[model samples]
Target chain A: MPATLAEKILQQHCDEQITGPGQIVRCRLSLVLANDITAPLAIKSFKKMGAAGVFDKDKVTIVADHFTPNKDIESAEQVKVCREFAKEMGITHYFEGGNVGVEHALLPELGLVGPGDVVIGADSHTCTYGGLGAFATGMGSTDVAAGMALGETWFKVPPTIQVILTGELRQWVGAKDLMLALIGTIGVSGALYKALEFVGPLASTLSVEGRMTMSNMAIEAGGKVGLFAADDKTLAYAAAHGRKGDKAIAADAGAAYERVVTIDATGMEPQIACPHLPDNVKPVSAVAGLKVDQAVIGSCTNGRIEDLREAAAILKGRKVSKDVRTIILPATPNIWRQALAEGLIETFMDAGCIVGPATCGPCLGGHMGILAGGERAIATTNRNFKGRMGSLESEVYLSGPAAAAAAAIAGEIIDPAKV
Target chain B: MYHGTAHTVGAHIDTDAIIPARFLVTTDPAELGANCMEGLEAGWIKKVKNGDIMVAGENFGCGSSREHAPVALLGAGIPVVIAHSFARIFYRNGFNMGLVLLEIGDDVSKIHDGDELKVDADTGVINNVTTGQTIQCKPVPPFMKGILDKGGLIPYVQDRLAERA
Candidate 1:
């Protein structure tokens, strides 16, 4: 049988035989990643392995974004461990929070990821890099330890599942809505272990950011990787990010797909995934006018500067609704600093939005923005599955930054277009 | 590698619920494995038999691409996982760690949580002792089968590299 894009990528990067689905293939990993949360354990594992040095120090990327301020004792210790490990291993691509953001957001921005590359992070959302046309996924500390020691990992090339998104999206609908819609249709496990290749006219309209959002949430719906062929948008994003060569790759037209899923965005309304399950989705109209207590506009998912700019554009000079509190968290300090320089922060403040630290904040519910019991908030973070952000009784509504900003201003679920 | 009958479950056995992110830092697999299904259906983990395979509906290992997930299962002595599908990162992580993943028909719902399933991967027959039913599972390609035979990526790489040297 003819191979699919995933197969071809695996073969190109394969040092030996390619493992089919259900079997294991021991192969060299092209890239390795870890963030604050998993880095401490990975460092410990590396110490036990007693390797002379990393197989290739430059290939390993470390970012400290999860707990930027070194929040408490535990988080500080994590960052301290990561720093010491990086220094000892002579890994040069170390990024602190000021220069870093979410690992998934920063990996592509720095051009460390590209087509056909097999990348792994200590994060579940590491699948987000599949948007860059790479076969990226998440790993555990032991697997990362092995990668650090041997510079390789094993894989089972998954069967492909095609998601054909047809028609155009209705107004105020964004990539988050598209993925949310898929989660609702597929019931979270619908795309399990299968490679989701997004094709059709709607796929073409999505930006790199949009595609990243879609792929970022693939883990939510139980997909292995939500991928798109390296097209102009992929190339453009790479070039703009300073990736000069060999970044773009196209899937062979006749690549085999295990199954094809169809999504019609036409006539589709803005969708909201209620707190506790990305699969528990309803049309925005169904939840409209529901009051909210807080609005969060950041995370690895929608905390990019573009996401902030869009939200800022809608909130300029408008006082936030009295019943709601809007909090904008730039994914990275760099995005935060950039937004500040461009006066976006001022606009947000003028609109009655409270600014937050550059860390994950309310998204992980680590600190800063935990919602009180019965407090309902609309957030732009990934994964609204029950008790994801805070109290199990506290409800979270998930949407894009624009929708979040709009809802914050209205103190209720209102469409961004209406604002 | 070991093999046995299969046990089945519904879709979205997420990593957070599989092995919550909170316990990811420790190096003790036994400790982590003990709490493997703390978030799963209450008392579900105790029902699993030693060496029994797990058949799932879809999106197995769906959240947080944590390797701890597969490690916990392997520590619990699971031999194989057959599903309609797997999450991408979890699939790679599982195979890299040498866990067997079988992608089979969507009709897996017919299999109970603890059905006595005999999976001869080489022959691609999933036999259920209770119902006397046998389902078809796509054969693992030779390349991938080679890795599973060698115990996972580490040992597999050790062998290949030694052979080359």
Candidate 2:
């Protein structure tokens, strides 16, 4: 009766006794999520399907993060649609305007997701909740609609890949580098149609926020979800945010994994994913001195308070290069408030960085900071796919917050330690 | 048989490349269609004729959970897509939208741009008139077959809920 963590969590949802990968079963969901860009479409579908109301208003969540603060008339209309729908449905977890933050970060910050929960969001980064030992994955808006009305949907249990991490990461190297290293090792399609299970000594040591960063980019590897054991750190994070879980969750000892990949974290330096692909990774040393016109230090992937603190620590007494326009976005309002409380905001302001509100802006090239033709940016956000942050000719270099902060100071990509 | 002319692209054509974030403002299919693949290559939509089959190397539709990616393709007159593989989200999105996606593994390379292809959705059989080859696609499971028959997930869910009622 042994099963992978994903299999166990999925089974718990449907109470299906026997199943394997590739077999579909209908499972209940702990949370059904959508956002400004996606919720409008889902609402349309929910109406098209003739559903008068949601299965459970409390379980449904809508966050206006993407293209929000009303980027344009069109995006404004999209948010309005979501707003009206949430109002009409009397949805408990609707977030917009001042309350809005990046969905993945805000959801975990609110403790809306915890161990053993099955979550599906219209945004791909929904899998970020896997940091709390939840089985979360992204679905299309249409899928979210069906899930909202029915409170359940079909799931194909994915095979698991055991990612064994050993040794400790060197200073200035952290979760983003580890994940970028893994994605580089696996290519973009390396973990397609599979769940990634993180284990080994290093897994227990990574902070919950760092683990969230690790799980946030699971989609970058084409993974169904990325999971860690619900150990003490996870419980503590949950409790701090007002969630309670009775027990820890982990894969059964004899659970099956389709593949085993080991990543040696010792002596590893900061990693960067170059232009066009996340799997197109290189050690920071490999691509030093690449000029950066913009340095963005936020997104759902690397926009937590911890990430900002790392950037602040580097920028404390230093100023960003006059040639570089550095932008920092704290992921949630609480994180933003915390950063303000800790005076990280003052450090960033003194260092010449533009502090923006908690929106997924600039990360998706929606607004805030856009790249011109032939311009390049060094960012702590996930994904460097071609033209992701602006002009098709504009290049994006993905890095950890330290490298991003250092790049802001140097006006080019460089080793953080050297700065 | 679903028939179309082929248009082949290389590997890892991400969702951002399929439809950029800037064009995601509307759920209108035509709006999404006009900007389809504009992120990867300009003038991509102009290349499509009605009922054209888009072919690609591995991991087509590899980023984001935007159903808009597949919706854009369908809106752009690409009713069928044959690729060596697909990322998890796009595969599900395509099926959920009732778009035909056939996984032909490496045999997808046998199809050249502008090749005439007739694909059988039920049998996973592909006939390439340009190469004179018969290729087998990765078969759809019976459960997913039912969803496709129902014209995607919404209609399928409606029927299932009706049965329960």
Which model scores highest in lDDT?
A: 2
lDDT for model 2 comes to 0.91
Residues A244-345, candidate 1: write the lDDT tens digits.
775566566877677778988988877889856688889888888999999999887888888888899889889899888788887766687889999999
> TM per model?
0.82, 0.99
Q: Score the docking of each candidate (DockQ).
A: 0.30, 0.82
Best prediction by DockQ: 2
The whole-model lDDT of each prediction reads 0.76, 0.91
lDDT of 2 by residue, A274-345 (tens): 989999999999999999999999899999999999999899999999999999999899999999999999
